[model samples]
Target: MRKLTLLIPILVIALIGVLSSVFVVDEREKALVLQFGQIKAVKEDPGLSFKIPLIQEVVKYDDRILSLDTETIEVTPSDDRRLVVDAFTRYRISDVVQFRQAVGVGGVRVAEDRLGSILNSQIREVLGADQVTSDTILSEDRRELMNRIRNQARDSARSLGIEVVDVRLKQTNLPEQNLNATFARMRAEREREAADEIARGNEAAQRVRALADRTVVETMSEAEREAQVIRGEADAKRNGIFAEAFGADPEFFAFYRSLQAYEKALQGSNSSMVMTPDSEFFDYLKSDRAAK
Candidate 1:
């Protein structure tokens, strides 16, 4: 019984040592075996790994792609216009050993902080170039600018064991204080355009109205000429008829003319004449044909 008790204690200690020496590295993780705070081995593959009992420790880091949102920053472009910029990056640890060596015990958080600084610096450099303008940053050319930033950051982050996969601008906006001013300027531009259109429309309307007035004047003149011609033709025809009657019978024509004169002189009931009876105006009234 005494020997069994001693064997049981030994077995228990052996079991604890075995359990502490064996470690696991999940498929989504990378591990570093540290002995006395010094890296001894790196485990990148999944399944099982081993470390010394009690003296060695394992530090695991995520192997998947990670994202970091950079702090919002303000930059000035070549045009002297300022913009507020926000961006994000996708990255992964390319060399865990290098990462551990660079970041030490601070781990992924320290690496991220350093990466953020690199991204911001590169962003400021690319955006502040003499040829880059605020319009370019807000336009499709922004994609090209982001690529440049990613390339620069990728090169810079290599010392930190970080591989920058992509970088993209999330927002590019005018500052809050500039929003109202920009809107006012836009409204003024629209108003000016509208005024120009109205002026053009008025000019066209005046031209059309002047043309209509000229057309009316021309039409009226043409109608007046036609009426004058008709009036002259009618007068000539009346005079020709009078001359034919006089040629056919002078005495009868004279009598008809005298009767027309009497009709005019006595057209009204109160019409009166003070002419002498022996006057030629009364010749037809006292002629011999009247007795017959």
Candidate 2:
């Protein structure tokens, strides 16, 4: 009967012990104490804690950094070009008290939503100034844009008692419809340029060929005229030589001239001679034969 009574007291003490305290808090966590469903204290420390077990609840939160990926959204540049952008943000709780007061047991979903809204607004403003992005330009003034976003996020997160570590753009792309149109236009322009180049080349070739033909005709005509002049001069020289020889001795010149004429006029087997009385070819013949 005494042992049973001692056991009852020990059980009561064990139950009290179980209901009155908390285990050691992890070094990487922050805790919030709630009394009867009402928040009473925030504990940002590690190790064992004392609390009313049945009436107090301790909500723990991670003290490490967290990341949130924003949805891909369409943005327009200043030049009226539209593109899809995917972004992400990294943040951490700066004030345990404020996080507890504002977020309660929900952690940072609300906070993340609020930050996403702020980021979206700032991104819209930044992207509005970008019209068409150049393929060669990295991020297209993205550093300046990130700087603007960082400043905005700093101000925003500070107001929410959170610290923004970094925000980054993951991808940027043209919309499917826009890509199709852009590619088609580029193809058409390239084709037009190629055609123009071909036409210019053909024109140039025709000019060169026409000029070559003109040069050929001019050269051939000049050569033929020069040949005719040379031949005429040669004939005149030959005639002059003959005249000089004939004047040097009239009788001998007459005989040589008659032989040359006979050789030319009587070239065929069936031949006849006909001449005037004063003809040089008949000078070698008798005057009676000449008359006949």
- Judging by TM-score against the true structure, name the best candidate: 1
- Candidate 1 lDDT tens digits, 96-128: 999999999999999999999999999999999
Clashes of 2: 3
lDDT leader: 1
lDDT of 2 by residue, 127-185 (tens): 67544353311356776677777678878778777888888878878889999998999
TM-score of each: 0.87, 0.68
CA-RMSD of model 1: 3.0
In model 1, what lDDT does residue 244 have? 95
User: Residue 31 in model 1: shift from native, Å?
Assistant: 1.1
- The TM-score of candidate 1 is 0.87
